[model samples]
Target: MAESANPIPRKAAPVRTKIDHLRLDVVGPVATLTLNRPERHNALSLDMYHQIPEMLSRLEIDRTVSSLVIRGCGLRAFSAGADITEFTTVRAGAEGARLYNLAVAEAERAISNFHAPTIAMVHGFCIGGGCGLALSCDLRLADTAAAFGITPARLGFAYSLESTKRLMDLAGPAEASYLLFSGRRVSAERALWNGLVNEVHPPEELEKVTYELAVEISKRAPMSLRATKEIIGLVRAGQVRDDDYTTALRNDLFESSDYIEGVEAFLGKRPPHFSGC
Candidate 1:
């Protein structure tokens, strides 16, 4: 009777290897991205450059994701800049430079216009293209160990006008010019003083503090945050001359669910639990 039937062996579950250069993880309403090429100090390869736009697109459409946090893996650096190896080939001539510049422009636009609030949780080196990524974020929280520079001058390359303007917006004309001219790394304190970063935390506390700040931001009204970001963009572009959309957004917020919850919670002496509706 025991030999009458044979049991079938079960197949093993698949094991997932970490992506070699980029890591994406979700915690509650926050999506965290890590540059994973630690052996090369997280140098930005062409593949890494392309993967960023796709990742940002994914995060943008995920309604559950209210905010994002970006940092480097292994704590050595956020990104040491573009992979110089690839640059040798990609920057070889005018045609090559044109294609490479187009790719960079697409990446920059994707990061800057992503729907959710984004935070750059920077540590160690954030230079060149890395600074471009960090500047695209709505907020930047750097560790005391962090350093920043835009090194196109040293490389005999001219930065895109949009990238230069973004840096100027964060650091002002004088500091932006100094860094661009010298190609010198600025200290975290200097970056903070120049408004390049929203806050500077100790190295050990950077991850924890950045996560806390992301959660705080995620708990706010989504519509208000999105509208504010859009309005800021219009203002920056010199396109916000008494627009009806901007006025409507301001009026609509008064009647939002978040506003109702906010008032009730205040009266009850409790924290508002916004659903982001």
Candidate 2:
């Protein structure tokens, strides 16, 4: 069989980190952030929620990382959602609930605002806050066996407005209402149809597919990626017209060295090496 014109780049040795219930692994330009409590279906503990923003901050400074994949440590789940075990104590009073909710929002915001593209590699159960985290990513690739749900209605808790908006944007208001009202688990195929997931793969092939996408994205001009991400965000925020900031952003890309390399490489029919300048 003829190989692809742009072959998948060979992966580099992963630099691993042990940060309690979460794991961070970087291989080449791709970083994998794993929810590591597999024994509890990769539930997000209170401390784990607190760690997310800090973890993302560390990655933001590493220019070498062009993309990130957020997943679970095991095949059983992407995340079953926030640890209910802590709800009684950590979310006990009005003050506790306020702080806990703030932590969740901040963590999701960090992921949503990450400079690089973020992919959520999901499998098994993605429920409640787990679904929120996945929705926060730029894209979601799921295993065929994966199931997704948001269950705040069942818990008698109000879902955050940010999370609800994200869901509404991806799956539309009708589908979002159904999920929110029923608290039913939708299969991977159904989720795909509803636009909840970008793609669905067999369990055995999920990792391969997700990482290949990450590598392909990493190969693009970094400035372009960042600019596009921000531009789309602006559009989402109802800024359709080009403002001073957008004009400056556009001007910078044109003046960048990567733009020159990209043009030259295109004319030469070769891959361009982007310096992210």
Candidate 3:
């Protein structure tokens, strides 16, 4: 049999687009969202905060995406936290602070509810609002050079119930209290020990290692992964009984295509190729 040769030409690469304080790049099934204000230690400005929810919405609906990585543009910071300079003018009084806090609450909600699994690759200063952002993600990976802190105490601002609870879920009540009350920077090793970070790598290996983790996650079944995330959120919110959902999901996984592939590959002594079905 002779193979037919076609003359259809390949299309040009899509134009790479970038927003003012954020950059989205997709390679294969993994998407990386970078906070782009490196000159300011990637501080979360009002504009950047507003842009996040919108960007996350787009990623959630994009079928091509299988995993997400949130990171800072430079090694100096994942974020230095909310831009305090803007707070001076934007949060001038009690009423203004109330409104600002409400907006922040909405942004945090969006991150916490993102459809796919998310990883925060933290380095340098991840403080105040940055900590809230990282804690919202499904997993957090920090570099050896990273520092973690929640600075509500230092700024004389009260932390929201949701943000406080998220931190407590990661580090337990006692550790969360220490960080929130003192506003002290903790080393990456301490953050890991306290359960704030799932993994810590050398500074030079951070980005590469983060991408590899994302790739591994992308190989899992999409439905099962998303269901697991949803169940975790339900448990965290105290809206559901853990045993009920846990057992149902475990049974559901047995019928999944990825699970079949995983088992077969194990028996066959080969690597499994999962389509995330």
Clashes of each: 0, 0, 0
TM-score of each predicted structure versus truth: 0.89, 0.95, 0.87
Report the CA-based lDDT of candidate 1 relative to the real structure.
Answer: 0.81
The candidate that achieves the highest lDDT relative to the unseen native structure: 2
Which candidate ranks first by TM-score, i.e. highest?
2
Residue 212 of model 3, lDDT score = 77
Tens digits of per-residue lDDT for model 3, 1-277: 1111111111323223378988876666777778889889988877777778887788777766678888887778999999899888887799878877877787788878887889999978898888888998889999998999899999888899999999999999999999988999999999999999999998877777887788888777777777888888878888755586578877887888888998899899988787666
lDDT against the true structure, each candidate: 0.81, 0.91, 0.82
lDDT of 2: 0.91
Find the 10 residues in a row with the least total lDDT in model 2. Answer: 1-10
Better of 2 and 3 by TM-score: 2
Give per-residue CA lDDT, model 2, range 1-277, as digits (tens): 2212222354566677768899887878988888989899999988998999998888898989999999987788999999999999999999999999999999999999999999999979999999999999999999999999999999999889899999999999999999999999999999999999999998878887888999999999999999999998888777979989999999999999999999999999999999999
For model 1, the stretches where C-alpha displacement exceeds 4 angstroms are: 1-20, 239-241
Q: Residue 61, candidate 1: how far off, in angstroms?
A: 1.8
